[model samples]
Target: MSLPRARFDQFRLAMMLLTRLPVGRISGAVPAMDKARWAFPLVGLVIGGIGWGVFAAAVTFGLSSVIAAILALLATALATGGMHFDGLADFADGWGGGSDRARTLEIMRDSRIGSYGVLALILFSALLAAGISEVASATAFLLAGVGSRLAMLLALVFMPPARADGLGRMAAGKGEASLIAGTLVCAVLVILAGTTGAFALIGAGLAMIVIGHSATRRIGGQTGDVLGAIQLASETAIWIFLATSAH
Candidate 1:
């Protein structure tokens, strides 16, 4: 029998929110990681939608572009409970502080943040904020929302699971068809936004591929934390590219 469509939608919504969506909360009771994997991109769409709305509001308010960008960034981080930020920090700490791959992974898994991780987080966050501010166009910001999430989708497509039994492994390889469907949808959204958006999407895709390859080579596979790091890096990369392209 086919899985229920409603259930699938719920799963998608849940995966996007750091497993905090209502669909995810319900699914949490049943414990199905395979469903969660397929649902991730859908969840990304929802998150992107929220970010787009915030950007729209900022633009409508006639706030300074920098202030609008800062608000949008904060909305994303807060909505997701800084899950991706944590991943970004951990990955930075691991890669920057460790001498080898094993040590790096070990360091990433640790709860403590090192100086390298802190610096990386600060730098990345500032770059993203500044980049978004420079764009100053509602269309560009919307495209950015879509582009960043598309990067996350690409990461899921390219990376392998780092651990045997964690969330990453469960959701790693199950939904190529679903992910492709989602990417196509995101592409349409980007194209609709403008030429600049199209360029941002292309840049984000390339960055994701490069990052995925590097992460896989370094650690042999992707973890949930790696997925988070991918999203954070890709989002920042998109903003940076858009900002430069705009100038």
Candidate 2:
């Protein structure tokens, strides 16, 4: 059965954003640039829901806080297939070890993880696990996920592409319209959930802007790896904010 045009477009864009699903079929149906521009944050909301549902279920089942947090992280990783983790590794290897832009790009292009990448991944994942464990409510967990993705959007808006090709380039210059739309949708949902998601949103936005600027200068622009790094870093930042406020 054929779907409505608008819904189909959203689904197609979501497919591109969520999974590493090939976009060959829908390549001509819509502009890749436009879809990539809007879909990233929208997919984040879906992923956030998945993470929150798992956390809520765990909480309802009388699970320990540590177990619930582990389950939530597992749910998110399964849903996104650790795409951002891969980005984090690449960014760390490139930025931490390379002596020059060409060298950094080459290191990032390498398929193997390096010492710096391993250390970065370990540290970041440990922090995430700890942060999620501190969340007392499912609402806060969900907001953290959504807020983190919004940070990713902010990164996309402010950071220059590291290269002239790849996913970052397609999404660059797409502007605030798509990001704003996604933000509004997430905001409304967060409000409906009876929590002040506004603070998380503001914190995430500020973190993204600051990090994006520094990252852009460090790498001379954004890359797919940079985008991933942004998500990973922003997610951690959001979680940190939530944890601090929870105290």
Candidate 3:
């Protein structure tokens, strides 16, 4: 296929995998998950745009900052089908409740949510909402959204898949080209937010280290749940930095 066509297919695939949005259909041969990794940040941009729109609209309609933040949060959640939230919950449940690798994997695979999962969701969701409410910058939202996904791409490229099968395994082994491409795209998005991106980048880096190391030590490598957990943590970190520094 032509280069541009291939890129288009990859973008469509990335959107399809990352969000619940209607991306129509790919015109020709579908690309592998690895090939589509470059567009992950693009998916973040789309989500951030949705969030910015909702928050702006809510605020324009005379909603309080908290209400606007919650509305924006809900919009992004709906856009992404709440998969990241579910991942965070599963990661917490598996990590907190399990004693060994096999047990952890088993817990994560279970459909039922546990106490650890509930607490994890509540804590992270609260942080996210609070941060969004405090920092009302469109640039902050866009930067955080893109930074979190960049963190995901980092884990997928740098870490091994914990299991022999699953989304992580299938999406693993992405080339450096994809990583570089995603990073460049992410850098452009972050630069648009000015120095605030520096703090957000620190947050994303810390999240990648903490989540990636813990996942590696506990379950041997990264998984979809781990990636999801990382995204949430990174996003929260970005928001906190933006909020605290907004003054």
Q: Write the per-residue lDDT of candidate 2 for residues 121-237, one digit (tens) a residue.
A: 999888777877886465666566666766676666767788878777777774777677667766775685444456556666676676577666677877878778777777777
Regions of candidate 1 where Cα sits further than 4 Å from its true position:
1-31, 59-62, 136-142
Candidate 2's C-alpha runs over 4 A off are: 1-4, 20-30, 189-196
Error of 3 at 43 (Å): 0.5
Candidate with maximal lDDT: 3
> What range of 10 consecutive residues in model 2 has the weakest lDDT sum?
19-28
Model 3: what TM-score? Answer: 0.97
Q: Top model by TM-score, which number?
A: 3
**Candidate 2 overall lDDT versus native:** 0.72
Report the Cα lDDT for candidate 1: 0.70
State the lDDT of candidate 3 residue by residue for 15-59, as single tens digits: 999899998988767898888888887788889999999999999
lDDT of 1 at 156: 60
| Candidate structures ordered by lDDT, highest first | 3, 2, 1
Pairwise lDDT winner, candidates 1 and 3: 3
